[model samples]
Target: MPSPYTVIEIFMTQYRCKRERNARKKFSNVF
Candidate 1:
């Protein structure tokens, strides 16, 4: 099984990707 730290890192990466996608969508709307 994966360690807790590894699981947290994975979640953080996913959250970051989601945030970036939302930012891109917002920029596209403005432009």
Candidate 2:
């Protein structure tokens, strides 16, 4: 089993990845 901090970090990374993908899509639309 993973530690609490590790699980939180993993979730954060996934959230960041999703945010980055959305940002890229928005940026592409601007140009």
Candidate 3:
């Protein structure tokens, strides 16, 4: 099994990627 910190890190990375994707979509829409 993975450690708690490792799991949290994975979750954070996924969340960051999602946020970046949304930001990119919004930026493209504005242009």
Give lDDT per model, in order.
Answer: 1.00, 1.00, 1.00
Q: Estimate each model's TM-score.
A: 0.94, 0.88, 0.96
Model 3 C-alpha lDDT per residue in residues 1-30, reported as the tens digit of each score? 999999999999999999999999999999
lDDT of 1 by residue, 1-31 (tens): 9999999999999999999999999999999
Best by TM-score: 3
- Lowest summed lDDT window (length 10), candidate 2: 2-11
TM-score of 2: 0.88
How would you encode candidate 2's per-residue C-alpha lDDT over 1-31 as one tens digit per residue? Answer: 9999999999999999999999999999999
Q: What stretches of model 2 exceed 4 Å from their correct place?
A: none
Clashes of 3: 0
**lDDT of model 1, residue 10:** 100
As for candidate 1, its clashing pairs are none
The true-versus-predicted C-alpha distance at residue 31 of model 3, in Å, is 0.6
